[model samples]
Target: MTDGEGWFVVNACESRWRDDGTLGSYCTFEGKRRFPHFGININVLGPGEALGMYHRENAQEAFLVLAGECTLIVEGKRRPLATWDFFYCAPGTEHVIVATSEQNAIVLAVGARGRGVGGGVVYRVSKEAARHGASVERETTSSAEAYAEAHADLPRSRWVPYREGWLPSDR
Candidate 1:
């Protein structure tokens, strides 16, 4: 929804969600709206679920654990994160977040967009990330190879309704 002005606002509950049954879901805030320079998303993960594969990008990235708990596997190391814990990854820092709490977790992810000017991604293998089903068998730079058949039996991500419980009011 938009006001009479040039800028607009959207509540998460009123946004669209991209859901992948096994890995969990997210509201990318980019359905009809395209964000230049950077991309952001609100990821929702249930216990034992992860947001994506283990990888490092030349573009900087960060994540805020908004609620519940998570385990951050970065460069083969493991660190537990709680609500309000902020994680920053400089360019080329391989990482992935996994839900470690009993309840569903909410993570706010923000990352620089575009692979131009030394921008690229490298999928890395991590024993820590692999336990969570987030690592590739071998180190590879191709996202397609790393994610293809990642969860063949599970449904791929598709737009769904903005799940209400993720909002603070519903918590």
Candidate 2:
């Protein structure tokens, strides 16, 4: 647990969101810093905000709710999630998470990475998600096409105080 050449560290509180400000991520470690093997992001979703278009990917993904609440729409089913809840999606398991709580929700997400992993993400339609205008009607591997009508810039996450003593130790 070090923040050296190979290891990285940053407090979620200090992380800046994308320009859009709908969601924020501690993605520097995995995106710009180029941490390899697997990728990790601390995602913050604002109230009523959808994670993304309803979609499934070739790579396996897991999420841990660190604060607030959300609804997990997976395979057309709605699952409510609260703090400390964990969700895992196998490759091709269509899913999306939408913040339903009044306050913004924080989720720690990790995904497998490597050759032969993450074929791509395909957006799909879901009646449950459609109720919130978060689903797509056609299948498409093009994220650009799926999000063509969306805000051009990616939004950043909002800052919030972490639960006391919940931050992981660097050791």
**Model 2, residue 36: C-alpha shift (Å):** 2.3
In model 1, the runs with Cα more than 4 Å from the true position are 1-6, 117-119
TM-score of 1: 0.90
Q: What is the TM-score of candidate 2?
A: 0.76
Worst 10 residues of 2 by lDDT: 162-171
In model 1, the clashing pairs are none
Using all chains and alpha carbons, the TM-scores for the candidates as numbered come to: 0.90, 0.76
Per-residue error for 152 in candidate 1, Å, reads 0.7
lDDT of 2 by residue, 27-100 (tens): 33332344556677776677887777899887899999988899999999999999999999899899988888
Cα lDDT tens digits for candidate 1, 1-171: 332435667877777788877778888766565676788888989999887899999899989999999999998999999999999999989899999999999999999898675449888889989899999999887766788757677766688887677666752
